[model samples]
Structures are given as structure tokens and as C-alpha cells.
Target: MSSEAEGRFHIVDVSSLTSVHRRMPRRVTLRTDDGVRIEAVYEPSRASVTDTAVVLAHGFTGSVDRPAVRRAARAFAERGASVVTFSFRGHGGSGGLSTVGDREVLDLSAAVRWARELGHARVATVGFSMGGSVVLRHAALEAGTVDAVAAVSAPARWYYRGTAPMRRLHWVVTRPGGRLVGRYGLRTRIDRRAWDPVPLSPVEAVPLIAPVPLLIVHGDRDAYFPLDHPRSLAAAGGDAAELWLEPGMGHAENAADAELLARLGDWLVGG
Candidate 1:
């Protein structure tokens, strides 16, 4: 634990951006409809000039301070967009237990609402893995919630336990012992209850997000969800969606490279 704390100094590498101007992020606490306290941070663009803000949602077992998320946030900031990174309930300092992707929509909704309250005219919600699925559902459930949305490495449907990683994830999500490990070892709290009526699927939610810019980014070599998931989402999105099947990429936030993140940031801000 001591060693882990020592290596946890987060470094934001935005040295490439000219006229780099970083503002210390304002930490915030938000509440979900279900009464959970969401831990969040608002990172103003290093350029300090932008009306657009991007809300970043991390993957399963990931927090706002995760290196990949931090790197992505910095990259987005360098591109001149303010960023809001938050920990979903059960992750990091957020309250409540994880519902996996079931009730996580409320968590994303809270973050999105917070971003809007920060006085940004345009807000884009960018999510990875489980967060990816949450954003899709949030967009569908809450109309006019955001201007643009990006889902990276999301699953189209639920209950998919095909890949080895996913199979292991199922063990983590469905079993009591796994929840214990999640609580103690991973610092994640898994909810003991089950989804009463499994929430809307990502494919089902895509069509409803019409007129909003939607970018579905999936890695071709992803070991968790396959190409079929993103393809289904794109099909359901009709003309409102753009799909980027990245080559050589693996999965989620950690697998997302800096180049891909920079492009995503640009797209979010309409650059």
C-alpha cells in the first residue's frame, strides 16, 4: 500500500501544446437521484479558452485518477476543451455500490449535469468500457442532456461472457466472493442486488440519440467485446453515428492511445 501511494503522483503531459495554460481543477461532489455522492473534478483547458467541455467516464474498476483517464483528460485539455472526470458510484471516492452497468446511468447523468452547471455551452460525454455503456443509456434516458457523445469500447448488449477477460469479469460481478475481492483488493464496491429489469441495451439506446453527434470507437483487436457490438450500435444509430474500428488497439480507456484520444477530443469540441 505504501509503495502504491508513492507511485501515484499523476502527471499530465500537455507539453506539446503551445501557450500551455493549466488551471488547477476544481474538485466537486455531486449527488445522484438514488442519493449517492459522486466524486468529480473539473479540469479547465490548459489553453483556458473554450466553451466546450468533455465529461470523461472511466471503465469498470477504474477511477478518475487512473493514469489512462488522467492522460486522456490532459490530451483533451490540450485540444482546448475543459474536462470533467468523475468516479462512478462504488469506484474511488464516490458513494454507493456498483450496479455494474445497470444503474450507472444515474452516475453519468450526475456528471453531465455538473459539467453543464460549470457554464459550458457545449458538453460532450465520452465514456470507456462500462462507462461507454452508461453514456449510451444516459443519452437515451435523458433527452438534450449533451451536445455530442463518444463511446469507446462499449458493449452493445448485456450478459456477454464470451471472452476470457469477460468471463473473469462475470465472476467478479456475479459472485459474493468476487465482490469481496473487488471491495478489498480493487477498491471497488459491487452491489449485492441484481438489476430488477436489465436496463436498456446500447443498441436500443442508439437510435434515440438521433440528431446528437455520436462517435462509437471500438478496437478491432479488443479482447472483451468484438466488432459485432459496435456494428450493431452503428446500425441502430442510423445516420447519427460514426464508427472507428481501430487497428492494434485492445480495450477500453487503458488501451486508448494518446493519438486516438487527441482525435476524440477534437471531435468532441467540433474541431
Candidate 2:
């Protein structure tokens, strides 16, 4: 990789074969509040952009190394925004089992804190699917945690099996046999435990994220959660939230295109 100065822009050429397609430059282990150690990667922004940072939370069954997550991170970094991506517990190299979205807030909190420690004055949290729900809850639970929040392909409320994909997901998350498949087949370790108090719903958490800029992105063609999901979240988010329903998109981070990701990166830093 080589760095060159061009007026106000700081250009980093990562296209060289020796440095292309490699992992991030900085990698660290963060400990969640519940004592789970998670693996996180930090991609520094271009020299011109050093004050704002974006933390990415992957969806259920996804890791920091997942292609979709990495693509999004690289997109943000390429646009001169520092990006931090981490695996929720039980997903990749992280410790502990996945409680789905229930206990994942701790994971995001740790990542956000790390970004702040890295000298970023403004931080944004962007999440997909289960991670999206987690970001809402985290923002609600930990006030002043982030300057902006973006949730993509997230369910407004939990326990809905309306779509066939959701039905299959229910089977994967609720049944013992399904969990066995998740552990072995999907390589996603789902805890055999249940939500005790059911935690907090994303719609309920939306109002609590007030005074902070919020962007809700979802595909109109998403097979997992339909339009009603983002609609409900926007309704709850009120005037502080902006919602974008894409026409031909599918699901989560995987469905995000280069242009959409660039727009999201701009939104994070108030561009």
C-alpha cells in the first residue's frame, strides 16, 4: 500500500497484489461487559478524515471476515471514514454463545468504546439484521454512545414468522435440532437459552434513540422481514429517523450495493 497527498484528499492505493485482499492493519480483542472477548478489526480512514469513525455490527451468523461485512467496511474506508467491524459473540473468533440479539449489545458497546479511544470525536453505529436490532438497543441502553445510527434489514419487533425465510429462521433459533444444525451446519453457535424478560424490542428502542441522527435502510423486496418492519421503525423513530426502502434489494448487508454503501458512509459523517 502507498499513500500520497493530493490537495485536501489523502489517497491510499491498496490495489497492489502484495497488499490487496488482506485483512485490516489493526486487529484487537475487546471484552464485552458480560466478560465475552470479541475479535475486532479497525481500518483507518484516509488522512484527511480522522475525526469521524463508523462501527459495523454484522448480522446473525455473520463475522468480521464475512465477505459482505468486509466489503462494507472497505467501502467506508475508501470514502475516508475509519471503520471498525467486529463479530458478535458466538459468530466467528469471538467467545461465548449467541443469544441471537439479546446479549449482543455488549459487543457493540465495546467496539464503540474502542473507536472513541482511537481519537474519533464522532462515531456512528451501523448494523444489519440482528445486529441492527442490537444497535438500537445499545443506543437506547447506553445514552450518548454514538452520534449516528443506521439499521438495515432489521425487524421492528421480534417473534414474527410471517415469511418462509423467517419461519426457517425460527426453526433454526428456537428448536434444539435447529440449534444443532446451526452449530454444525452453519458454524453459528446459538445458545440453547431463551430471552428471560424478552429484552427490548427495536420499535420500542427507536424512540429512545432520539436527538441522534438515525437512518433506516431496508429492501422492499427483502424476504426475511417485509416493508412493515422498516415502516414500523420509522413510525416509532418519528421525525429524527430517515427511512429508505429500495426497490429490488434482498436482505441485510449482502444486499447493499456500492452506491448504497457510499451513501450510508456519507450519512454517517453528515455529508
Candidate 3:
């Protein structure tokens, strides 16, 4: 793995952009710190109302091309901030298998770097499910690289199998047959090995992200993680972080409605 953390873009004819193409979504490829190829899309803001760019991260089985991910990105763009949506390695057009949220921090970092390289004065990240945990860890690890971070339906701690969805998720990542299902059924490639050193959990990383404007948004009806997960993260974040418990909501990106996404965009740009 190369020590280089900044990403290099590919496939997007990033030459001089005319006003006509400036609003079109441009597809690009990114190389991560550990050297993984990622697929991404860059969408210019509708109104160009904010200098902040929003980097969006998807869920466990989600990708940059997923409807939920695209919806969030479009909504953010409509709010007047450029948006970069990327598929983590192993999902979509990216290369490599998923390490869940551990090594995925590098993935988010790459997207953030790309957003900054595009000349955005500030960058904010909003991630869902597996990606939710990645944003917290990435902000904590990269510190001031990003202006703000928001995580939705993220688990506070690791190895949580309390919920039925989580228990099934464990099966999908750990077992060989489950891995096959993850690959063939869900189009998500699973890494066969478990965490060697067991990276820091989201709650553990929350304190490190203090004063960076962290937001933890979770649903009261999340089937993957209970309210305790967000509560634990909020407690760790203390006053530095804001917690929003969405009533009657479900889980991850699919559950994130336009209203919630618009509210998220408002909070991110405001922060």
C-alpha cells in the first residue's frame, strides 16, 4: 500500500468545463490511501449558494449508483452545495473487498480530498449505515480535513449483534455461504477475515471529532441498530455533537426521506 492519501481522478474529461456541462453529473474513478480503486460521481450544486461541498457515503450493500445514495446527493446538490458520491471498494465499480468500516475510512478520505481538490472551500460528509460509521472515524482520523460530519444509522460500538438485522449482517460477512450471498445476491464483496487489531469504534472516535461539528442522526424505528447506539454516540460526543432522533423513521439511506435530507443539508451548510 502506498503512503499517498490523496486521490487521483480518472474517466472524467476534467478539461475546461463550459457552463453547459458544469451542471451535469461527471463520473470519475478514485484511488484510496491504501491504493483501492473507487467509483464516484461529482454533481455540481444547483444554485451554487454555498461554498461547502458534501461528500456522501453509502451503506453496507449500497453503492454510489444506488437510488438512495443518488437521491441524497441530488437533494444536497439542489440545496446549493456540490456533492461527491463514491462507492466503497468492493461495491459498484470499485476494486477490493469490504472491510466493513475499518479500512473504509480511507475511502471517505479520498472522496473528501477530491471534493477539496475541486476548489470547494469546505467539505461536509453525510454517510448511511456502514458508511455512517466511516464518516465518524474518518473525521476523527483526518481531523480538520473536513468541516463537518453527519452519520446516520451508525453503530456506536463494534461487534453489535443485538438486532436481528445486525445478526444477519454478521452472518453475511463472517460465514462463507453468507459471503457468497453477499456477493451474488447483494452485489457486495465481503472480506473473509475478521478485524486483526479491531479498529476504534464510532463511539471511541466520536470524542476525537469534537469541535468539528459532528451530527449523529438515527431513526427511532431503525431495525439494524436501536436507539441506544445513537444515545451512546451522543453521550460520547457530549455538547460538541448534536443528536437527532427521527421519529417514525427506519434505517439507513432508503429510510432517509427528502424532508430529512433537506434538514440534513441545512444543518451541514449551517455548521
Which 10 residues in a row give candidate 2 its minimum summed lDDT?
Answer: 1-10
**TM-scores of all predicted structures:** 0.90, 0.90, 0.92
Better by TM-score, candidate 3 or 2? 3
Summing lDDT over every window of 10 consecutive residues in candidate 1, give the lowest-scoring window. Answer: 1-10
Q: RMSD in Å for candidate 1, one decimal?
A: 6.7
Query: Better model by lDDT, 1 or 3?
Result: 3
The residue pairs that clash in candidate 3, if any, are none
| Model 2 lDDT, full chain set | 0.84
User: Candidate 1 has what TM-score?
Assistant: 0.90
TM-score, ranked from best to worst? 3, 1, 2
Clash pairs, candidate 2, are none
Q: Write the per-residue lDDT of candidate 3 for residues 153-211, one digit (tens) a residue.
A: 99999999998889999999999999999999999887887888899899999999989
Candidate 3 CA-lDDT value: 0.85
> Which stretches in model 3 have alpha-carbon errors above 4 Å?
1-24
